[model samples]
Target: MGNVRLRQLVIAAGSLDVADTLADVLGLGEAFLDPGVAEFGLVNRVYGIGDQFLEVVVPTALTAPAGRFLARGGDGGYMAIFQTDDLAGARARADALKFRRVWNIDLPDISASHLHPADVGAAIVSIDEARPAASWRWGGPDWERRAAPGKLTGAVITSAAPEQMAARWGEALGIPAKGGVIRLADATLDFGMGKEERMVKFQVSLPDVGAACIRAARRGLDVVNDEVRIGGVGIVLSG
Candidate 1:
């Protein structure tokens, strides 16, 4: 098996309004509008978050899947993408586990398998591999060094049965979890008990939490210590 890293997390917002809000709060500027995603009746903008990326999709058509997702809540996490050096190995494991992949794409530069959320657990888990190692086509060109206020550090998945979901995810990805926690190269995935299973929160490491909180306050957003809820997700500013 190959080592995997949490490379990107996607949010489904009502519209680009949430993306605009996130750009201000995260100090992120570069946005890649992937034309390919329009086939899904959605508009996608990928922002460079340190070396990783953050993608936000807004449904355009009435029947878009994201539209159904937004109806449940407002805006929230829609998917999680993991970068694996050995995507083939991950796919083989998925087959053994009887995991169903809802979508798949293979290009000259990258290949991705989007697993069915119902089959996996909390959310849509995507395993992808990009050639030339560090090149991320989905994140746009030369985005690795883009400076941002903070970098994503972790994600929290709230599940009815936390340990089981964690184990299920680990099994499908070939990364065994210990007590509902999966450690990656630059971040961690924590599964905690909740009434429902969902991507409830994500962590960002900021150099100046106080300053960021002040900025958020200026925008009339509620900031309780290090966490601020905006763009349909709770951002824990880990200093």
Candidate 2:
């Protein structure tokens, strides 16, 4: 999308232990622990990837939504958030497509709406607009500091009907897919065919994938070729 940017990505795990390993593997420096998420029976930490963010949430209770996702054999790539300049326009498009908002927040600094996963047909999707275009309240203060500046470049979502799912997301975002890839301002979403719908992989643009793979190996992470597994998702390094 011309005006939309890939702002944040989220992962769900069974425990917060993934935080340390992921940080070590990705060279993510400081993390912000948000207490507000406990209200949803979960605990989370947000790591800044430059101005963008990578967050991981683990369920504190068995009945939590993330817990249910894990119970269904899901543990990675929970949500993909995009920052748009016109949230109202996005919501109107979503409404026209019959996509329901499962949760939302409105504040002076930020406004966001999470779409229903069932309707999205893959991973959870959130459309948000941050005031001033660059500020993100969810990533917490001083998130601008980081050890490395790995950018979120793309995400790979698998669905039984990949083309149709991509069409739905593309239409909702006002950026139609080229083939099966929905291109954004800073990232692209690639939809692939799978037995079931889920977010399977994430792509990041880094200075050196070789160095990242070495670090991942030292952390005892599962590194295969140019991809590393953390929090039950494949993090592929490119560029």
Q: How many residue pairs clash in each candidate?
A: 0, 1
Candidate 2 lDDT, tens digit per residue, 1-239?
Answer: 33998888899998888887777778788899988889878899899887788899999987998888889876888889999999999988888889998888999999988898888877778999999888888888777764358899989998888999999888778899888889898889999999878888889877777888899988877777789988878999886
RMSD of 2: 1.4
What RMSD value applies to candidate 1?
1.4
As a whole number from 0 to 100, the lDDT of residue 83 in candidate 2 is: 94
Q: What is the C-alpha local distance difference test score of each model?
A: 0.85, 0.86
- Clash count, candidate 2: 1
- Give TM per candidate: 0.95, 0.95
Which pairs of residues clash in candidate 2, taking residues 3 or more apart in a chain or in different chains? 1-184
